[model samples]
Target: MKTIAGILFIVLGILTAYQSKQAQPAAIDYAKERVQILQLIDTESKAFWDKDYEKWASCWAQEPYIRTMGWWKAGGVTVVKGWEERGPRTKQHMEQHPKPNPQNVRRENINIRILQDAAWVTFDQYGKDNGEPVMDMPGLSRETRFLEKHKGKWKIVYVGWLLEGEGN
Candidate 1:
Protein backbone atom coordinates (compact mmCIF):
# COMPACT_ATOMS: atom_id res chain seq x y z
CA MET A 1 0.00 0.00 0.00
CA LYS A 2 2.81 2.44 0.89
CA THR A 3 4.71 1.80 -2.39
CA ILE A 4 1.55 2.34 -4.47
CA ALA A 5 0.88 5.69 -2.73
CA GLY A 6 4.47 6.87 -3.37
CA ILE A 7 4.20 6.01 -7.07
CA LEU A 8 0.91 7.87 -7.36
CA PHE A 9 2.38 11.00 -5.77
CA ILE A 10 5.32 10.95 -8.21
CA VAL A 11 2.99 10.58 -11.16
CA LEU A 12 0.86 13.47 -9.93
CA GLY A 13 3.92 15.71 -9.62
CA ILE A 14 4.99 14.86 -13.17
CA LEU A 15 1.53 15.60 -14.51
CA THR A 16 1.36 18.89 -12.68
CA ALA A 17 4.72 19.97 -14.07
CA TYR A 18 3.61 19.11 -17.60
CA GLN A 19 0.37 20.99 -17.21
CA SER A 20 2.17 24.11 -15.91
CA LYS A 21 4.57 24.00 -18.83
CA GLN A 22 1.65 23.85 -21.23
CA ALA A 23 0.00 26.82 -19.54
CA GLN A 24 3.08 29.02 -19.95
CA PRO A 25 2.82 31.73 -22.60
CA ALA A 26 4.90 31.75 -25.73
CA ALA A 27 8.02 33.89 -25.67
CA ILE A 28 7.09 35.73 -28.83
CA ASP A 29 4.13 36.48 -31.06
CA TYR A 30 5.65 36.85 -34.51
CA ALA A 31 2.80 38.85 -35.98
CA LYS A 32 2.73 41.40 -33.18
CA GLU A 33 6.49 41.77 -33.08
CA ARG A 34 6.60 42.19 -36.86
CA VAL A 35 4.14 45.06 -36.70
CA GLN A 36 6.05 46.80 -33.94
CA ILE A 37 9.30 46.45 -35.81
CA LEU A 38 7.74 47.73 -39.02
CA GLN A 39 6.49 50.82 -37.23
CA LEU A 40 9.95 51.40 -35.84
CA ILE A 41 11.41 51.20 -39.34
CA ASP A 42 8.94 53.73 -40.67
CA THR A 43 9.69 56.15 -37.88
CA GLU A 44 13.43 55.80 -38.35
CA SER A 45 13.12 56.32 -42.09
CA LYS A 46 11.07 59.42 -41.58
CA ALA A 47 13.55 60.78 -39.09
CA PHE A 48 16.38 60.27 -41.53
CA TRP A 49 14.52 62.04 -44.31
CA ASP A 50 13.68 64.89 -41.96
CA LYS A 51 17.26 65.00 -40.71
CA ASP A 52 16.02 64.47 -37.18
CA TYR A 53 19.08 63.05 -35.51
CA GLU A 54 17.55 63.04 -32.06
CA LYS A 55 14.64 60.94 -33.21
CA TRP A 56 16.88 58.71 -35.27
CA ALA A 57 19.15 58.17 -32.30
CA SER A 58 16.16 57.16 -30.22
CA CYS A 59 15.65 54.20 -32.54
CA TRP A 60 19.07 52.80 -31.72
CA ALA A 61 20.12 50.99 -28.57
CA GLN A 62 22.15 52.99 -26.08
CA GLU A 63 25.88 52.60 -26.53
CA PRO A 64 28.75 51.47 -24.32
CA TYR A 65 26.74 48.31 -23.76
CA ILE A 66 25.22 46.96 -26.96
CA ARG A 67 27.45 45.26 -29.50
CA THR A 68 27.14 47.06 -32.81
CA MET A 69 28.49 46.95 -36.33
CA GLY A 70 28.12 49.15 -39.38
CA TRP A 71 29.08 47.98 -42.83
CA TRP A 72 29.27 49.67 -46.22
CA LYS A 73 30.44 48.48 -49.59
CA ALA A 74 33.21 51.03 -49.77
CA GLY A 75 34.42 50.71 -46.19
CA GLY A 76 33.77 46.98 -45.85
CA VAL A 77 33.00 46.86 -42.12
CA THR A 78 33.35 48.99 -39.02
CA VAL A 79 32.76 47.32 -35.67
CA VAL A 80 31.70 49.71 -32.95
CA LYS A 81 30.88 47.94 -29.70
CA GLY A 82 29.00 50.76 -28.05
CA TRP A 83 26.55 53.43 -29.19
CA GLU A 84 28.74 55.96 -27.38
CA GLU A 85 31.41 55.45 -30.01
CA ARG A 86 29.10 55.20 -33.05
CA GLY A 87 26.62 58.00 -32.41
CA PRO A 88 28.96 60.97 -32.69
CA ARG A 89 30.77 59.58 -35.70
CA THR A 90 27.48 58.99 -37.43
CA LYS A 91 26.24 62.47 -36.59
CA GLN A 92 29.40 64.07 -37.94
CA HIS A 93 29.24 62.10 -41.16
CA MET A 94 25.59 62.95 -41.76
CA GLU A 95 26.26 66.57 -40.95
CA GLN A 96 28.85 66.64 -43.73
CA HIS A 97 26.64 64.74 -46.20
CA PRO A 98 23.30 66.39 -45.88
CA LYS A 99 20.28 64.73 -47.45
CA PRO A 100 19.19 67.37 -49.90
CA ASN A 101 16.69 65.17 -51.77
CA PRO A 102 15.23 62.65 -49.35
CA GLN A 103 11.96 62.46 -51.21
CA ASN A 104 13.68 60.53 -53.99
CA VAL A 105 14.92 57.84 -51.62
CA ARG A 106 13.45 54.40 -51.97
CA ARG A 107 13.35 51.20 -50.01
CA GLU A 108 12.15 48.09 -51.84
CA ASN A 109 11.59 44.43 -51.14
CA ILE A 110 11.67 45.00 -47.42
CA ASN A 111 11.52 41.81 -45.36
CA ILE A 112 11.46 41.42 -41.60
CA ARG A 113 11.78 38.48 -39.23
CA ILE A 114 11.51 38.29 -35.49
CA LEU A 115 12.88 35.72 -33.08
CA GLN A 116 11.94 36.32 -29.48
CA ASP A 117 13.60 39.58 -28.41
CA ALA A 118 15.64 39.81 -31.60
CA ALA A 119 14.73 40.80 -35.12
CA TRP A 120 16.33 41.46 -38.51
CA VAL A 121 15.32 43.21 -41.70
CA THR A 122 16.63 43.24 -45.23
CA PHE A 123 15.82 45.45 -48.17
CA ASP A 124 17.03 46.98 -51.40
CA GLN A 125 17.63 50.71 -51.06
CA TYR A 126 18.37 53.32 -53.70
CA GLY A 127 18.06 57.04 -53.65
CA LYS A 128 19.59 60.47 -54.14
CA ASP A 129 22.75 61.04 -52.17
CA ASN A 130 24.69 64.29 -52.21
CA GLY A 131 21.98 65.59 -54.57
CA GLU A 132 22.55 62.88 -57.22
CA PRO A 133 20.54 59.72 -57.72
CA VAL A 134 22.37 56.80 -56.22
CA MET A 135 21.27 54.74 -59.19
CA ASP A 136 23.47 57.02 -61.25
CA MET A 137 26.39 56.44 -58.97
CA PRO A 138 26.73 53.33 -56.79
CA GLY A 139 23.27 52.17 -57.92
CA LEU A 140 20.97 50.03 -55.80
CA SER A 141 22.33 48.42 -52.67
CA ARG A 142 21.18 45.71 -50.29
CA GLU A 143 20.86 46.53 -46.60
CA THR A 144 20.41 44.34 -43.54
CA ARG A 145 19.79 45.47 -40.02
CA PHE A 146 19.68 43.59 -36.72
CA LEU A 147 17.62 44.90 -33.87
CA GLU A 148 16.74 44.03 -30.31
CA LYS A 149 13.98 44.93 -27.89
CA HIS A 150 15.32 47.22 -25.18
CA LYS A 151 13.37 49.28 -22.68
CA GLY A 152 10.13 48.43 -24.42
CA LYS A 153 11.48 49.63 -27.75
CA TRP A 154 13.06 48.00 -30.74
CA LYS A 155 16.48 49.47 -31.39
CA ILE A 156 18.93 48.80 -34.20
CA VAL A 157 22.19 47.19 -33.13
CA TYR A 158 23.82 46.36 -36.42
CA VAL A 159 23.50 47.60 -39.97
CA GLY A 160 25.20 46.39 -43.13
CA TRP A 161 24.97 47.47 -46.73
CA LEU A 162 26.41 46.03 -49.92
CA LEU A 163 26.58 47.81 -53.22
CA GLU A 164 24.88 45.80 -55.92
CA GLY A 165 26.50 44.51 -59.12
CA GLU A 166 30.07 43.64 -59.81
CA GLY A 167 33.07 46.03 -59.56
CA ASN A 168 31.35 47.89 -56.74
Candidate 2:
Protein backbone atom coordinates (compact mmCIF):
# COMPACT_ATOMS: atom_id res chain seq x y z
CA MET A 1 0.00 0.00 0.00
CA LYS A 2 2.75 2.46 0.90
CA THR A 3 4.63 1.76 -2.37
CA ILE A 4 1.48 2.31 -4.47
CA ALA A 5 0.78 5.69 -2.84
CA GLY A 6 4.39 6.87 -3.44
CA ILE A 7 4.18 5.90 -7.12
CA LEU A 8 0.89 7.79 -7.57
CA PHE A 9 2.33 10.94 -6.00
CA ILE A 10 5.38 10.82 -8.28
CA VAL A 11 3.24 10.34 -11.38
CA LEU A 12 1.02 13.28 -10.42
CA GLY A 13 4.04 15.51 -9.89
CA ILE A 14 5.44 14.67 -13.30
CA LEU A 15 2.10 15.33 -14.98
CA THR A 16 1.82 18.75 -13.35
CA ALA A 17 5.26 19.77 -14.52
CA TYR A 18 4.49 18.66 -18.06
CA GLN A 19 1.23 20.58 -18.11
CA SER A 20 2.90 23.81 -16.97
CA LYS A 21 5.54 23.59 -19.67
CA GLN A 22 2.96 22.82 -22.32
CA ALA A 23 1.05 25.96 -21.34
CA GLN A 24 4.04 28.22 -22.18
CA PRO A 25 3.52 28.38 -25.94
CA ALA A 26 2.05 31.88 -25.71
CA ALA A 27 5.09 33.11 -23.85
CA ILE A 28 7.43 31.55 -26.38
CA ASP A 29 5.43 33.04 -29.21
CA TYR A 30 5.56 36.48 -27.63
CA ALA A 31 9.31 36.26 -27.29
CA LYS A 32 9.77 35.21 -30.91
CA GLU A 33 7.47 37.98 -32.13
CA ARG A 34 9.43 40.54 -30.17
CA VAL A 35 12.65 39.38 -31.81
CA GLN A 36 11.09 39.62 -35.24
CA ILE A 37 9.97 43.20 -34.56
CA LEU A 38 13.52 44.17 -33.62
CA GLN A 39 14.84 42.46 -36.71
CA LEU A 40 12.43 44.53 -38.78
CA ILE A 41 13.79 47.64 -37.15
CA ASP A 42 17.30 46.54 -37.97
CA THR A 43 16.31 45.99 -41.57
CA GLU A 44 14.70 49.43 -41.74
CA SER A 45 17.84 51.06 -40.41
CA LYS A 46 19.68 49.47 -43.28
CA ALA A 47 17.10 50.69 -45.77
CA PHE A 48 17.41 54.27 -44.53
CA TRP A 49 21.21 54.19 -44.58
CA ASP A 50 21.22 52.60 -47.99
CA LYS A 51 18.58 55.01 -49.32
CA ASP A 52 15.94 52.30 -49.65
CA TYR A 53 12.94 53.99 -48.12
CA GLU A 54 10.59 51.34 -49.39
CA LYS A 55 12.65 48.51 -48.01
CA TRP A 56 13.21 50.39 -44.77
CA ALA A 57 9.53 50.99 -44.36
CA SER A 58 8.62 47.50 -45.48
CA CYS A 59 9.67 46.04 -42.13
CA TRP A 60 6.74 47.68 -40.44
CA ALA A 61 3.21 46.25 -40.22
CA GLN A 62 0.60 47.14 -42.84
CA GLU A 63 -0.19 50.37 -41.02
CA PRO A 64 2.58 51.01 -38.56
CA TYR A 65 3.10 54.03 -36.36
CA ILE A 66 6.56 55.51 -36.81
CA ARG A 67 8.42 58.00 -34.64
CA THR A 68 11.40 59.14 -36.64
CA MET A 69 14.31 60.77 -34.91
CA GLY A 70 13.71 64.52 -34.30
CA TRP A 71 10.52 66.32 -35.32
CA TRP A 72 7.48 64.52 -33.97
CA LYS A 73 5.79 63.84 -37.27
CA ALA A 74 3.37 60.89 -37.13
CA GLY A 75 2.68 58.48 -39.99
CA GLY A 76 -0.27 56.16 -40.54
CA VAL A 77 -0.34 52.59 -41.79
CA THR A 78 -1.81 52.76 -45.27
CA VAL A 79 -0.65 49.26 -46.19
CA VAL A 80 -3.57 47.57 -44.59
CA LYS A 81 -4.38 44.87 -47.18
CA GLY A 82 -1.04 43.76 -48.57
CA TRP A 83 1.68 44.54 -51.14
CA GLU A 84 -0.58 46.93 -53.04
CA GLU A 85 -0.51 49.41 -50.18
CA ARG A 86 3.28 49.34 -49.84
CA GLY A 87 4.58 49.00 -53.41
CA PRO A 88 3.55 52.48 -54.47
CA ARG A 89 4.69 54.50 -51.46
CA THR A 90 7.94 52.58 -51.33
CA LYS A 91 8.69 53.15 -54.99
CA GLN A 92 7.83 56.82 -54.80
CA HIS A 93 9.92 57.50 -51.73
CA MET A 94 12.89 55.71 -53.27
CA GLU A 95 12.50 57.53 -56.58
CA GLN A 96 12.38 60.90 -54.90
CA HIS A 97 15.41 60.14 -52.75
CA PRO A 98 17.34 58.34 -55.48
CA LYS A 99 20.00 56.14 -53.86
CA PRO A 100 23.22 57.13 -51.99
CA ASN A 101 20.99 57.62 -48.94
CA PRO A 102 21.78 60.36 -46.44
CA GLN A 103 21.60 58.13 -43.38
CA ASN A 104 24.02 55.35 -44.42
CA VAL A 105 23.86 54.59 -40.74
CA ARG A 106 24.17 51.52 -38.56
CA ARG A 107 22.45 50.55 -35.33
CA GLU A 108 24.60 49.00 -32.58
CA ASN A 109 23.80 46.91 -29.51
CA ILE A 110 20.02 46.66 -29.33
CA ASN A 111 17.91 45.29 -26.45
CA ILE A 112 14.21 44.49 -26.29
CA ARG A 113 11.68 43.92 -23.53
CA ILE A 114 8.30 42.18 -23.96
CA LEU A 115 5.23 42.88 -21.89
CA GLN A 116 1.61 41.75 -21.83
CA ASP A 117 0.55 43.94 -24.74
CA ALA A 118 3.56 46.19 -25.26
CA ALA A 119 7.34 46.13 -25.60
CA TRP A 120 10.40 48.31 -25.04
CA VAL A 121 13.43 48.40 -27.34
CA THR A 122 16.72 50.24 -27.17
CA PHE A 123 19.64 50.44 -29.57
CA ASP A 124 22.59 52.54 -30.72
CA GLN A 125 22.49 54.05 -34.19
CA TYR A 126 25.20 56.09 -35.89
CA GLY A 127 25.08 57.64 -39.31
CA LYS A 128 25.78 60.65 -41.53
CA ASP A 129 23.61 63.67 -42.18
CA ASN A 130 24.31 65.55 -45.42
CA GLY A 131 27.76 64.09 -46.03
CA GLU A 132 28.82 64.78 -42.43
CA PRO A 133 29.32 61.70 -40.24
CA VAL A 134 27.14 62.29 -37.19
CA MET A 135 28.79 60.87 -34.08
CA ASP A 136 29.13 61.10 -30.32
CA MET A 137 25.68 60.09 -29.13
CA PRO A 138 26.86 58.69 -25.82
CA GLY A 139 25.50 55.12 -25.49
CA LEU A 140 22.00 55.47 -24.21
CA SER A 141 19.72 57.52 -26.46
CA ARG A 142 17.41 54.52 -26.21
CA GLU A 143 14.07 54.41 -27.96
CA THR A 144 11.11 52.71 -26.35
CA ARG A 145 8.49 51.31 -28.70
CA PHE A 146 4.97 50.23 -27.82
CA LEU A 147 3.65 47.18 -29.66
CA GLU A 148 0.28 45.47 -29.90
CA LYS A 149 -0.63 42.12 -31.36
CA HIS A 150 -3.25 42.65 -34.09
CA LYS A 151 -4.99 39.67 -35.68
CA GLY A 152 -2.12 37.48 -34.46
CA LYS A 153 0.52 39.87 -35.80
CA TRP A 154 2.52 42.43 -33.84
CA LYS A 155 2.40 46.10 -34.80
CA ILE A 156 3.87 49.24 -33.40
CA VAL A 157 1.35 51.47 -31.69
CA TYR A 158 3.72 54.17 -30.45
CA VAL A 159 7.40 54.96 -30.19
CA GLY A 160 9.44 57.56 -28.37
CA TRP A 161 13.18 58.28 -28.61
CA LEU A 162 14.75 59.46 -25.35
CA LEU A 163 17.77 59.12 -23.12
CA GLU A 164 18.28 58.40 -19.44
CA GLY A 165 17.21 61.13 -17.00
CA GLU A 166 14.75 62.54 -19.50
CA GLY A 167 11.08 61.68 -18.96
CA ASN A 168 8.68 59.29 -17.23
For every candidate structure, what is the RMSD over all alpha carbons to the true structure, in angstroms?
A: 5.0, 8.7
Note the residue pairs that clash in candidate 1: 63-83
Candidate 2, residue 71: Cα displacement in angstroms equals: 5.0
lDDT of 2 by residue, 40-69 (tens): 666655665566765655555555344333
lDDT of 1 by residue, 22-115 (tens): 9886778778888888778777666766667888789888756655454445556657677787678657655765663354446789898887
In candidate 2, residue 51 scores what lDDT?
61
TM-score of each: 0.67, 0.47
Q: Candidates' lDDT values, in order?
A: 0.70, 0.53
Q: Local error of candidate 2 at 4, Å?
A: 38
lDDT of 1: 0.70
As a whole number from 0 to 100, the lDDT of residue 160 in candidate 2 is: 51
Candidate 1: minimum summed lDDT over ten consecutive residues — where?
Answer: 129-138
**Model 2 pairs in collision:** 49-104, 63-77
